[model samples]
Every structure is written in structure tokens, then in C-alpha cells.
Target: MTDIPRNPLIDQDVWTGRLFGGAEGSWYTAGETRDVTEPATGERLTNIGLARAADVARAAKAAAAAQPAWAALPPRDRAAIMRRAAAALERNLEHTAHYVARETGGIPAKAQLEVAEAATQLHIAAGLPLQPQGLVLPSTVGRTSYARRVPHGVVGVISPFNFPLILSMRSVAPALALGNAVVLKPDPQTPVSGGFLIARAFEEAGLPPGVLQVVPGDADAGAAVVEAPEVRMIAFTGSTAAGRKVGELAGRLLKKVSLELGGKNTLIVLDDADLDLAASNAAFGAFFHQGQICMATGRIVAHRKIAAELTRRLVEKATTLPIGDPASGTVAIGPLINARQLQNVDSIVRASVQAGAVLEAGGTYERLFYKPTVLSNVRPGMRAFDEEIFGPVAVVTPFDSDDEAVELANRTEYGLSCAVIGTSLNRATAIGDRLKCGLLHINGQTVADECVNPFGGRGDSGNGGSMGGPADAEEYTQWQWVTVKGAAERTPF
Candidate 1:
């Protein structure tokens, strides 16, 4: 806030140069620093410490040191603390959401939606502490046997820039609720709303210092988390290529891992589908938060009979969504997260248009503000169809039959979410059955998530892991088999 102009919304105390290592959420100022940028204006937001491996090691050490006592707390007691954490997050929603909007260049509405969802994650996790954590097993040897769920001790989390708060909390809150201490490394792009704000919430809620670490850092810090011997598991949300690296490194260390990666999601419009319903879902799915969501519909496969009308409708809607800076609190869509993302979106659009996809509505940008675009006659091989363009672009490809629609949808390496829109529930259900995605919607859109429901992806989209109370119970803990015999049973050697 000294040289960099203080934003009226973003609190200066949260954006300072101090880095909060996981060691009880204490400030660590010994490191090289980098500037956080406001994507809309290409201006410096604030300087933050650039964390190296040593910083992560310190956090891991703290988590490992603090985990046992946290785990020793009564289950109901832990639940009480989790509820307090959720309340703390709720009280600070508006204040932290301002940081999310400015830092990610997302509309205020979108930022608030994610912030509210993040708090919901904590609330849902608050119920996990009292759930039965072990199963009674049958023993053939006349000995009582049991399988008990135990904390992995320390968990390392690496969250992505897009949808930062919820993604990080989806892992962090549950791990804490289930008694595993966590060291969270939020994406360097959105450290405050993603990392610092979460740390502040938990600290205010009286979570033991060192139980949840917030380290805003780069790849070196993430790698250190995975490599630390004291850290028993890794929960990462990022790109597929990056997920692969995290998986490989964690595998070599024989550690537990959960990865939520990229998506090239689709929505199918049957001949029987209402054109208005299909077009509305397609536009919202493709352009919400500038299509930065992992569940954003990248392709719309419509019946040949209704494809033209659907495309026309999408084009009409696309031109009407306001596009500009979110700080103004007026636009539906805001700037891309950064210059590189802007370039990537533009390149894919240009290449797809050159390959013969009709640029029906939008294909231009002013600075980082890429217009909500709709394309028709898109094919499987085109860049728009093949790559995950995490931008506000929608592509429509016509399918002659249900079989062909299923074929077109399953062709991608990513199988995250799919929507089948038709009046007939039976018909939609059949088509949804043939699709290879982890999440399916019938007579609905692909962009949806509820904290209580098991949500995840398959193949490149994720490692078949989910985020919910039940899924969290499985992912955050390890099972130990215990057997007991009267008077010390003897075994022949």
C-alpha cells in the first residue's frame, strides 16, 4: 500500500509483503518477492514473498508437529471448531470477496458466489468429525478385528488460480475436520482471497496454529510439499499436464494423492430439446466467469434439425452480455486472468475460425476483455473443439443421431461434465448413460456444484476422486487394521 495504490475494497493489511508460513500462520518475511497483478489494467496490485522449497519444508514440519494433538481431540470437539471456522468465514465474506474480484478479475457476483460456496464447504465438513470412522471386520481366528480410519498426519494442497477459494477449501476444510493438519499452497496469481483470507478465517476461529498453513507460492513450494516425508498426502487442483507431474512425484514417494484437473466439457441438444432452454444453458455454461470453470461447457452438440436455430439463439444472447472491468460492478463478463490466457484464448479462436468454424457472434478483444463468442459448424479436429479454451467461447457441432452425439462427446481426453437437454427424461437418461463423464445432467446445464454432493471428474479431468463429505472422509484418512486376542495369542514361527 506504500507505492502501490491502495484499492478501496482490498484491505491493505492482507496485501502486505509478509508471507504467512503454515507455522501457526505467523508472518515470514525472509524471501524474494514478486508483484501480484490486476489483470484488467496491467497494474501491480501488491508484492508477495516468492516461496522456495525451504518455506514449504518449514510448514510441513509444523503440520507434522501439530497433527497428533489435533487428531487426539474428541470428534465432537473437532466438529465444534469446524463450525466456528465456517462462521468466521461467513462473517468475513464481503470483505474477502472484494479481494477475490480484484485479484481474479471476476465480477463481484461471481466472486461472492465462490466465497459463499467456500464457506459451505467448511460447514459441510463440520459434520465429518462425528461420522463413524472405522468398520468392524469379521475375524476367522476368533479374534475381534477392526478397520479404523486414521489421519495421514500432514496433507499438502496445491490449488489453482481459477476458482481458488472453493478449490482450496474443498480439500483444506475436510482434512482439518478429519484431524489431518494441512499445508495449503494457493496459486501465486490469487494468494489473498485464496490463501491469506482462508488462513485468517481459521486463525480467528481458533484453529491451532500450524494446523492449517497458507503459503502463497510457485512450483518450487508445491514440489517441496509433495517431497516432504512428513507430508503424507497431496490434494492438487490444476491443469492435466501439471496434475500428471504431481501424480508421478507422489507415486514415487508412495503417498496418497487426489487431483482435480482440466476439462473440455460438453452439452448435448437433442432434436426434441426446447431451443430456448438449450440456448440459454449453452450461453450460461460457456460464458459464466468468462468460461474459467472446470465444468464450463466447451462444446454444444445439437441435432442437425435444430442446430442452426440453437446457434442463432446463442449468437443473439452472446452479443448482449456486458463485457468490461468488474471493478465497475456493471459487466456480466470481465477480463481474462492474464495476458497469457488472453493470447491462448485468441489463438484457439483464430485457428478454429481459419479451419472453417463460423464465428457467429464474437471473436475479438479489447485488452484482456475477450467478448463472449459463439461458433458454429465446429469439428472434432479444430482447436476450439480439441483444446480446453478457458475463455468465453462456445462452439456448436451438429450431430445426426444420438449415437453420433455420444461419439462426439466421448472423443475428448477430458471426461468431466456433460449435459443432455431434452423433454423426454427416458431419452436423456439413455444418452447420459453412454457418455463417459464423471458428472451428468439431464434436462439441465453442466455448470453446477453442491457442496454436499459428490463432485469430481474422470480421466484427464481428475483421478476419479470427488469433493464432498463422504469423499473427503475417504481421501483425507488412511485405514489401519487392528486385531485383538485374549491373553496374548501365540503364533508358530
Candidate 2:
């Protein structure tokens, strides 16, 4: 193993196998540790402590204990703290971006984007508490009735390694704003930058102790967080398979769970669409961050009339994207998270080619750096078209008509997001309205997400619950109806 150089951006002492928890700002060391490696160079960045099941329980208890005081504070007060946290995040943006780039194998530009998105999410969540909650109901002559939103006490957040900061904050910020305490477990692969930095931001922002806990660990720790009795709700973002397991466990415990899972997102281009714009956006949506996004465009449905031109343009664009070390600043695409992911992507490409899909641009790799790949002639039966290929590979299939386009788009079990590109906005809107996905983009890519939008999916992509804007506050809370009766004029016989 290469000797990892010290990163000026991170506190070496704090990052070496320490978990953050409690209001006293204490750090605890676990019995076992795991080495975190940089995928760009296969160098061990640092050893992270793995939290055990007991640790999860302890953190949950602490969050539960701290929730009441946090809930007791006025919404504006909570909002103030959240805003301060956002400011702290902005102040540390440079360091955080560097850490994210190195740890997650994302290019500096994408890492910076992630940090910016996280800060924006925090700022948006700050305003959630100020939004109107519940409603007054018309009642009988002498009675009044109303419903109010209330916190769910302790919320467990399980975030994936890819886009860890944004995904975690999707739940943590909203949960905090709604007066619920949070116990966060970031993916073990990206504990320091993805998990620890957010904890530090909150601590520096003067959040009360114990209200927020950051525990970094493997699957055991994740299961513990789900099984903990004190965790009233769980907000999870990961693979569809893992999400099912979380849902099953949380269901057994009768805990409310919100899941954001995998997607085989589709991007459709009509015959009248500008081929250049469609190809460029498709390349961006498919290859951005090595295509490690849930909303990445995995499948492209194009009108048969323009399919050849669109495929040619996409292939031309894919070959020019820089793929190298993330820290170099000039690279566009970086390494996959690990060898397993690299193998998974390569195998999928190889299998699709063997199954009769034509590889138009890229189908090669050295170590973890995969070339941006575009596969044409992809049919319905090919795995590349049917499954979620979480890599920089775009599979294109031709559709004869608008009805055929909608049919092909909705054929997949996953309905997370879809994009429609066409010359006419009215035509695009007409097609988008017919799509079954949770999110739709007209004349754009499928990966765009706004800070104020309720972000999530439908069908296997997620539950009906969303993760941003005012809807998030509702997701993290419960409703309680309060009724008052005037003095009775007569007694019952």
C-alpha cells in the first residue's frame, strides 16, 4: 500500500477511527477499524472506526433523549440553527470538496457541485419550519377541531456512498427542522468526508448535544440502526435490494420508513428534437459522476427517424470526456468507488455486447477508470436495457411513435425519473404528462433536481413520500388532531 499523504483539509486526529455523538461533543473509538482507500490511486486514505450494534443503540438513545428539548424550541429557533449550519458548510466548502473528491473518486468539479447542493439543501430546510402546518376544520356549533404536525422523535438516516452529503442532508436537515433528532450512518466507504464533515458542521453551528449523531460503519451497524427501538422512523437512500431489506426490518418494528432506491431512468428524444442538444444532455446525464447517480440516464429511447444521428452524436461526445485522477482538476470522469463496481460495470457492458447490443464508443477500462460507453441497437431483452447499470454507459433503443416511446419508457419496473426532449414544448409536455415516473424534465436531462422540489420517485423507485421542500417536513412528522368542546347545555339521560 502506498503511504497516504496528510490532507491539509482534514484534521488527522479527528478522522482516524473516531465516531461523533452526544451533546458533550465526545468521540469514541470502536473495537474494529476499516481502511478507506482512494479509488483514483488505490491508496489508503485513512482508517475509519466501525460502529457496532451497541453503538447504534447508544446513539439512538442519545438522540431520543435530546429530541424533546429540540422539539420544545420554537420553529424559528431551529431554523436559525439550520441556517448557521449551512453557513458553516459554505465556510468549509473547499476542504469538504477536496475530501469528497479524494474519498468518493469524483472529479473536483462534481465534488464541488455536491457540496454546493448540500449547502442549498440546508438553506432550503431552514425555511421548512416557517411553512404553514396542518389546518383548521369547520366543526359543530359548540366545538372546534384542528390538526397539527408533530415530530417523530428519533429518525435514523442511512446514506449511500455516492452523493453522500446531499442524500444524508435530504433527511437530516428536514428531520432537524421538524424538531426530530437524527442518528446518521453514512456508507462505510465514505465516512470521513460524507459523514463526519456534516457532523462537524452541526457541532460548530452550536446545535445542542445529542440531537445529532454521526456513526460510520458497515452493514451490521446499518441493521442496528434499523432495529433500534428508539428510532421512530428511518430515511434510507441506497440500492433497491438493500432498500427492501430495510423496509422489511423497519416494518417488523412498526417504524415509518422512507426509501430512495435505484432507477433505470429513461431519456427520450423525439424526431423533431435538436439532435445536438439531446446528445449533449444525454451524455451529461449518463456519464456525470461516472453515472453513479440514481437519476442517471441509463436508457435512451429515440425516434427511429433520428436514432442514427443521435447515437452518432452521443458516441462523438462520449469519447472526448477526460477520465483520470480526480485531484488533477482537468479530468471529467473519475474512478469507480472500488474494484467490485468497476467489474460490475465492465461485465454489464461485455454482456450487453455479447447479447447483440453494439458498442458504439467506449467499452474499456484500466483499473477503476472506465471509459464513457454508449451502446446502440439495445433491445428490450438486453440486460443493459432492462436493469439499472450504475455506470457511465448509455443504451439507445429506437421507438417508432410517441405511444411507442411512452410504452418503452414505462416498461421498466423502476420509475424514478424520466426526460423528454422535443422541438415543441407542448409536445414534450404532452408526452411527459403520460410518463409514470416521479420526476420529469421537458427538453432536458433526467438528473436535474431543484432545492425546493419534492425529490423522490414512484413504484420501485420509492414510496410516495418525498425528500425535499415542504413535503419533507411532512414526511418526517406525524399529524395529530386536537378538538375542544364548549360547555354542554344539557346532560345526557
Model 2 stretches with alpha carbons more than 4 Å out = 1-9, 485-493
Compare the candidates by lDDT and give the number of the best one.
Answer: 2
Give one digit per residue, the lDDT tens place, for model 2 in 385-492: 998888999899999999999999999889899999998999889999999998999989999887788888988898766888757867899999988886656768
lDDT of 1 by residue, 1-493 (tens): 2233233324556547766655555666746778888887777877777678988888889888888999999988888887887787677677667668888889999888988898888888888888898999988777899999999999999998889988899999999999999889999998876787777777667787678877778888889989999999999999999999999999999998998889999899999988988899999999999999899999999999999999999999999999987877899999989889999999999999999999998899999999999989999999999999999999999999999999999999998999999998999999999999989999888898888878889999989988775688889998999998876767796
- For residue 92, model 1's alpha carbon misses the true position, in angstroms, by 2.3
Positional deviation of 159 in candidate 2, in angstroms? 0.5
Q: What is the lDDT of residue 131 in candidate 2?
A: 86
Alpha-carbon TM-score of each model against the true structure: 0.96, 0.95
